[model samples]
Target: MATLQIDADNFQPTITNNATVIVDFWAPWCAPCRGFAPTFEAAAEKNPGIVFAKVNTEEQQEIATAFNIRSIPTLMIFRDQIVIYSEAGALVPAAFDQLIEQAMALDMDQVRLEIAGQQASS
Candidate 1:
């Protein structure tokens, strides 16, 4: 599937949906963002079951700020409404593939428990 263009309008619902979502935070002005665009799309094409999405920081500052995105081309992976991985910089094809494999293998129940435990501790 192609990458979804995420914005303030659809950010909440898109992430909350029960799917493995890979969100790319970028801006048109950033060189690396442009360079990484094709790689992201290619990855999307390779993984049909995953939801590959993009949030243009310049166009959707609200969504960008919510994620505290300090740099362009940040990649975040979410599953079951929880953020499983977040990092800045572009990931090479191999790394991106590895991330997909790792995220797919997670025990979501454990992930949820960890989230709940952290919430309760605070």
Candidate 2:
């Protein structure tokens, strides 16, 4: 699967609708981000069920701000619209794979219930 480009406009709904979302916060000028791109892309290909989104901080300032992204190559994992994991820095392929496994291993039922609760209250 190719990495999906996400901007401020589509980001919210995309993450909200997906059962699992992995967002790569990156900038084109950052060397680490550029280097990590292939690894990220590989991960996306390995996991077809998950939604992998790439947010270019330079072009999508609002999306970057919403996530409080202070560094390039940050990875944020969202389950049912709530952030479950957020880390700053570029990850090697092995570490990135582990992170994805961790995200997948999480209790998704709890996440779904939490989202439901939030929706019920709103």
- What are the TM-scores, per candidate, against the unseen true structure? 0.94, 0.87
Global Cα lDDT for candidate 2:
0.90
Off by over 4 Å in 1: none
**Candidate 1 similarity to native, TM-score:** 0.94
The most accurate candidate by TM-score is 1
Tens digit per residue, CA lDDT, model 2, 14-116 = 9878988999999989999999999999999999999999999999998899778898889999976778899999899999999899888889788778878
lDDT of each: 0.91, 0.90
RMSD of each: 1.1, 3.2
Runs of candidate 2 exceeding 4 Å displacement: 110-122
